[model samples]
Target: MTRHLPARTCRDCGRNRPNHGRGLCRGCWLRQWRATNGRYDVATGTGMGGPGIPKTAADIAARLEDYAFLRALNVRRLDIAARLGVSYRTLNRYDARLRQQQDTA
Candidate 1:
């Protein structure tokens, strides 16, 4: 005997088809994945920007300032990253860069 699964409607297109998770059908899911350049998180359904914080000097300075303030409060690295809207790896890079500058000065 074969099991018959009920068709699921995609949240984006509303077409009935097999679900690919995140309440989206395969086609819609693939569309979203490509749209985000594969940054789509299937589990959280959010795309944390691939490159992370903008590369502008002012933006980097501002984020680093925020990072320092948050660090002074003893915030966890993960929390700091989320608050800064960056990934943990990016935060680590920022931290290292700041340390390097401080060392040189």
Candidate 2:
């Protein structure tokens, strides 16, 4: 006897996909995973990470540079936040803080 499988669509993007049991396609799942800093919890549909703060000046500078790069790419902030494993609000806050610091210098 042979079992049959049905094609499914990703819940996020509505793209045809395999049954991954999470209702999300590979690419969508990966985006979620990356947004969560590689800590996606399927059961809860959530992500976990440490405090959202740059530990050093170098780290802050690097992140600012990364933000600039993302801006140049014209990527949406939501996408950028997901790609960087942060919340949209957090991203906005960080950007505001960084911009303020830059202006003061």
**Best candidate, lDDT:** 1
In candidate 1, what are the lDDT values of residues 1-105, reduced to their tens digit?
Answer: 965656898889989887777999878888787776633122121244334333698888998999999999999877777676666667768889899989999
Off by over 4 Å in 2: 1-54
Candidate 1: worst 10 consecutive residues by lDDT?
Answer: 38-47
Residue 49 Cα positional deviation in candidate 2, in Å, after optimal superposition: 7.5
Off by over 4 Å in 1: 1-54
Q: List the residue pairs that clash in candidate 2.
A: none
lDDT of 2 by residue, 23-58 (tens): 987788887867756432211213454445545878
Give the per-residue Cα lDDT of candidate 1 at 85.
69
**TM-scores for all predictions:** 0.51, 0.42
Model 1 residue pairs with clashes: none
